[model samples]
Target: MPIITRFYGIIIKMYFNDHLPPHFHAIYGEYNGVFDINTLEMTEGDLPNRAVKLIREWAELHQNELMKIWEKKVFKKLDGLK
Candidate 1:
């Protein structure tokens, strides 16, 4: 997994040549969730409400960039929430 961003103890990552629906992984401690880039919804796994909210906010801010990276199957560090 390649880390794309990190903030507030949350780690965001995406794997090269990953599965469909264009998604990224969010991890915090023992919690992990796979979120759809288009819908910004958790497709699998679970995370705390607060973490989920923060992730949604961050994702909203970088949705386009996320899609670009996903389509290119390239890793790029993104700016995280302050």
Candidate 2:
């Protein structure tokens, strides 16, 4: 897994050549979730409400970049939520 960003104790990552539907992983404390890049929906696992909110906001801000990285199968760090 490659870390895409980190902020407010939230760590965002994605796996190279990962499965379909284009998604990313978020880890905060002991909670973790796999979020769909397009819909911002948690496909697996669970996260706190605050963490989910932050992840959604951050994803909205960088959706395009995320897709680009996903399509290219290249990982790059992204700016986290402020």
Candidate 3:
């Protein structure tokens, strides 16, 4: 997966050029995961103790923006807001 965004305890990524409801991949060092941008569900993978906490917080903080980026990306928006 491509590393799109990275922060203190999280890394946001999109993969395989596919989009339905919009989601992102998050990684926190020893912990990595695939999460839904809409419901904030941990669709797959595991996160470490601190990573889990940070992932939850980061996702909540950027949920809207993440979803928006996913939408714009898949839809091929010319002036996409990233």
User: How does each model score on lDDT?
Assistant: 0.95, 0.93, 0.67
Q: List TM-scores for all candidates, in order.
A: 0.97, 0.96, 0.70
> Which regions of candidate 3 fall more than 4 Å away from where they truly are?
74-82
- lDDT per residue as tens, model 3, 30-68: 777878888888778878666666676777877776666
lDDT of 1: 0.95
* Full candidate order by TM-score, most accurate first: 1, 2, 3
Looking at model 1, residue 10 earns an lDDT score of: 97
Q: Which residue pairs show collisions in model 1? A: none
**What lDDT is reached at residue 47 by model 2?**
95
User: How high is the lDDT of residue 75 in model 2?
Assistant: 77
Report the C-alpha displacement of residue 51, candidate 3, in angstroms. Answer: 1.1
Query: Considering every candidate listed, which one attains the maximal lDDT?
Result: 1
Which window of 10 residues has the lowest lDDT sum in candidate 2? Answer: 37-46
Please write out the lDDT profile of model 1 over residues 1-82, one tens digit for every residue.
8999999999999997888999999999999999999999999977999999999999999999999999988789999998
Model 3: residue 65 alpha-carbon error in angstroms: 1.0
